[model samples]
Target: MKSRRRWRWRWEHRGFALGLALYTLLLLLLVSYMLDYGARRGRALGDWAWEGQPPPAPPPGEAAAPPAPRHEAKRNESEDSDEAGPGSRAGGKRHIYLHATWRTGSSFLGELFNQHPDVFYLYEPMWHMWQALYPGDALSLQGALRDMVRSLFRCDFSVLRLYAAPPGPRDPLAPFLPGGGGGGGVNLSTASIFGWRTNKVICSAPLCPAAPRARSDVGLVDGAACERSCPPRALRDLEAECRKYPVMVIKDVRLLELGALLPLLRDPELDLRVVQLFRDPRAVHNSRLKAKQALLRESIQVLRSRHRAAEPRGLPRRHPLLPPGAAAALAGVHPRQQHRAEFFLGGALEVICQAWLRDLLFSRRAPAWLRARYTQLRYEDLVLEPRAQLRRLLRFADLPSPPALEDFVLNMTRGAAYSSERPFLISARDAREAIHAWRERLSREQVREVEAACWEPMRLLAYPLSGQEDGDRQEGGTVPLQMFV
Candidate 1:
């Protein structure tokens, strides 16, 4: 009887141990699957990605090495060399950043670089970064933004993949249907994902033979393939090409705080030159208002369409279910929405004026080394005398004043007429008219208000206040206080 009891106990215990081991193995597998799923979801969701705390820094000795200066332009090259053979990556590269705010003629300036066969131009790579961290969440976001830019400069476009992913189906019901049948789904073309004009120009350039072929069959390949194949290779070739080219230029309007990018300028590896572009405050404000109005009209139309669609489901005409904060957060992602939100929040003009003041002060206070790399360019000056200003700019950047450069400027400006309200198109017509057009557009009171808020910076930047300012102060009692609507 004792032998029999011992055998039974042993059998029970062995069975229980086996069961426990199997359960543990199954649990481990399940956890691994969950982690993989979460990572894939994160890549697809962009801003909604589960970006927990930032990763810890590497140990002191393991940190990344600073970039080395790779290329230096040859001053002895003939002017015709500008149109010569494929750009060589044999020497150190020249990097130029054209920093500006909205409504400034930065697009035109950027195009000047774009037209150069030897120059590889990037248009607002930071636009994706801004969308990912909209409303600028301060230190963390700022650090991320700078890091993204650093990666781009070094020819690593992997960071951009975070924002390049196509958003998953927003409507739940569509997934159940064949072909994910949602009529209004987000369609992200290669051109749209990358900039339209920038992509067109880059593809046609000699370095990217694969690009033009890929463009013809854009629908066949997925975004992932395009992301994998094009940007990385293009950037790599450009990095190599930089050795032969005089300069590589990047233009961005979102960099309102120039001081934040001081690290890049100070980097010994990067021969970075900064061109600070500013427009008249009044013109900037007016352009912003016009854009906001157009966007608001579009938003209203979208809301109405949603209301019509919801009627069959017995839903409210307005999306009353969303909290104000949630709606505002959604709106904040887009520039136009942010503009409207700011207008209602008041002090829109003050905000623009303050930005001008802050940037001017930051530029003025830059250290000697940084100041050496910096050059200020006014929109008025660029527009008024394209050839002379561009010649000066190229010389400052150490680029040859090739005849091709002259042809590019004349072709770009004369081909498209300049319009303050519509700045995307290049206009060669009298740029001076666009300069002070804001004076006539803004009312006397509005002009006075802007001038009052921005007098110091305006004076410092050499922008004269309208003579009507004195008259407005005298009639201050009767003049209704106006704000940006």
Candidate 2:
């Protein structure tokens, strides 16, 4: 009996030990799972911070939606303004922003809208703010830029006077003079508005006697004649003309971040829609290289803004060499100094790519209102299929796609010859040559640098990496949509 009791006790202890070992194994797995989950959650939160919003949680048991179809991604026109704020009303004028950086063919894109008779288009209105506040970091100037954009959309041209006026003891005509009241500020007028010479509205009828307005008018404006005929008009008169149009569009390169424009996006009265244009970074880099001298100041501002953002608040440091008044002196920089400008401009491309990545990621995770109000466009696609792309653009802006507009787009892309004489000139050009020109113009090393710096956005934008055939033509690649709407 004593022997049987000892064996029974030993068996009982062995059973308890076995159960504890199993429990410990299970506990380890639970802890490991919790750690992994925490890591994934942290990464997701970091990404959401880019856009300032977290994506909505998925429903239980729902598989994640597949990547958006090409057409769905491009066709983001949301007809229901139910989500649009209280200021939204039926039949309100549509406001559009042609969001692009400098020299991405934005001038040509804006020209398309400018030629539309029913549209009132302003080109680079923020240019006044940028020029007025030169040496101000781009990040610091965003508030003023946003305000200017908001006011312009409302047809309150008076806001321009804040930046447009000569900085010294104010003279109304100071903006018209070569130097702002002898302070050497920008020369401003209805005639001096960026791209005003090519503006159909400014060049036609009520604004100028150069050409009579016609419903079928789709020809490029004769900029020389327009400059000769159109005199400076009062701000109030410009506003009056602005009011007559059913649609208002502004093209700007100064607004760097999509998040910066959220307030405008939320404004119901303005009913803003954005057509954000992107170009291959390699091409943009090539173009910037060609126009480096002209773009130096802007490039400096872009770089300084990025550097300033990373500093602790109130650090107050500025580039020792780049003083507020030093911009005027860049024109005389010695040949050796040109390398410094090139280096600075190269940094600017990185800033631009960073901005592109931020905008793209934000748009992808954006809420319904944002998704509704935004559209993404590629410069390559625009030139490759002008007619189809133009129709889609007009559709997004609620404009009619007329035959004259079609003809205008076709003729603009097919020119007599490729010319770099007027790099910034808005005229017909050989589209194919323009698209492939960078291949020959950029050295292999230069191409590699641009690709290396911009690889993230290049991938997201579907641009093929160097030496790869365009994915659009490759197996398993998407076919370009014949129509977006």
lDDT of each: 0.51, 0.69
Candidate 2, residues 403-451, lDDT tens digits: the string is 8888899888888765556676678987777777788898766776676
User: Per-residue lDDT for 404 in model 2?
Assistant: 85
State the lDDT of candidate 1 residue by residue for 1-485, as single tens digits. 99999999999999999999999999999999999888654332222211223324446764555423322243224344333323222235567888876556787787676655446567777666655444443222444665666565554555666654455212222233233221111333223323433343335434445553432221112222333334433333443443345467778765534555655665545567888776667666655555554323222322232212211111112212333333332332222333453343224445445545656655554555556677887666666567887887877676656676676565544433335344343445445456656766766555555555555556556565565344442221112211111
Residue 238 error for model 2, in Å? 0.9
lDDT of 2 at 34: 95
Candidate 1 TM-score, C-alpha based = 0.57
Candidate 2's displacement at residue 158, Å, is 1.1
- Look at candidate 1 and tell me the lDDT of residue 246: 49
TM-score leader? 2
Q: Model 2 off-target regions past 4 Å?
A: 1-91, 167-189, 210-216, 310-338, 470-485
Q: For candidate 1, which ten residues in a row score worst on lDDT?
A: 476-485
Clash tally, candidates in order: 11, 1
